[model samples]
Target: MISTRLASLLFCSLVLLACSSKPNQDYDTGYDFSQLHTFSGITTASNSDPLSAQRIADAIQSSLLTQGFKQADDTAQFKVNYTFNITDKPKKSGLSIGLGTGNWGSSGGVGIGTSVGVPIGNDSAKLQTIQIDMIDIKTQQLIWRGSDNFSFDTGGEDKAQLTQQTVAKILAQFPPQESLK
Candidate 1:
């Protein structure tokens, strides 16, 4: 009865916690993003998952093309870099307290297994950060950046589609709108 309700509430809370955070964008305020024409090299973070990274890169390139940008052969105006970071954040489970008087002595201890962290997909939930940076070729400096934070499972289904969709969401903040910068 009461335990069932508590379990349901906990499950709902975990789902909410694993929800996606909106994409964020930042750029050098002094930089004029509109002046940029073509870009190249969406090099990914070292040791990042290759297949997933490819999906992300393709989506980003497609999005940039749609934004009226082109791929360059050499000395492109800007260089793009991307990275995916995943961290295992252990959930803080609750401990139950018990107090009573026993025949031998006073019995008081914390009961274990009072709470358990909810799982995501087929495995544990993880905190995921996806970042994309745009660097000025001539200056060799970062001019614009976009990122997104979310909780998800590494073993999720349709991983390719997930990567594509996430890339779309992150790149939607790209080019650093003038007013936003």
Candidate 2:
């Protein structure tokens, strides 16, 4: 019973340790513009899974259009592309200890206490980052971009919902609205 409790605790600790840290946003402030117009022929950085890339790109484009941007197929103002990079890091397990106390009595009477030691196990997981970039078609300089990090889970029916959430987050910085003075 003690060993089973220890194993459960260890498993929970390792699961918490595998979560990835958040990524920071790096944007260029010099190119601040009130309105952004889309460019023709929006392209994607080569991805291992073209179908997945298309799904993500389509979602992103839809979000941008809803935000009042026009999509161009010819010469346009801005070009969009997305890239993803995955990395794995090692994680160490967590250890915990418990203590118990007991008492002894004379006249052949005695009391006992219990203690437990939890030994956690080490594990590894990949940290996936999706970077969406918007570039000025004329100058070829990156005007705006957002990178987000997520821990990948293979089996989930919420992928489409999650993708929509990610798209909304990334485009929240777009249009570059200025503060009222």
Candidate 3:
């Protein structure tokens, strides 16, 4: 029984990991991340909506602050910019039907078979992508970037929670590990 429970737990862990989006991170290897202590984020008007943009901006600030980074004014050392996009994802659910006819095992006997698949649940969904970029104010150049893509059912998800979760996932790797350099 214990082994069965353990196996079930392991399976659940793997499934959750597989479902979560892993951010694609890129950074300037030559830049020293330790010297940067303050940040300000720019949320473009192009973000899906004003409320979502605010949620993302707030999430980024909260994450940075939790990481011991301070928010600054226009003179901040590094500035953050993000873009959020949501588009209608094509429906992958539909009806499938198949029919087959052939001679049966019996002599001169005819056989027929048919199968139909009717998909259920909501077919409308959206694909969302959030891209975060960190730029050096002095050089006006990108120093770090992370982005991830995820999808959600159009009707069920809480937009704020989803935005927070997505932003956190992307920024969790900020200030790229030194060992990676």
| Residue-by-residue lDDT tens digits, candidate 1, 141-169 | 99988887555555445555666667778
Tens digit of per-residue lDDT, candidate 2, span 1-181: 4564566568657756765444345556777455456555556777886655766788788888888788886857888888866567555345544433333463222233344544245356555566788888778899877777655444244555656666667777675444211
Candidate 2 local lDDT, residue 146: 79
Q: Best-fitting candidate, measured by lDDT?
A: 3
Sorted by lDDT, highest first, which candidate order results?
Answer: 3, 1, 2
How does model 2 score by TM-score?
Answer: 0.61
Off by over 4 Å in 3: 1-16, 91-121, 155-157, 179-181
Q: Which of 1 and 2 is ahead in lDDT? A: 1
Which parts of model 1 have CA positions greater than 4 angstroms off? 1-20, 89-123, 154-157, 179-181
- For candidate 2, what is the lDDT? 0.64
Of candidates 2 and 1, the better by TM-score: 1
TM-score of 3: 0.71
lDDT for residue 145 in candidate 1, whole number 0-100: 85
Total clashes, candidate 1?
0
What is each predicted model's overall lDDT from 0 to 1? 0.72, 0.64, 0.77
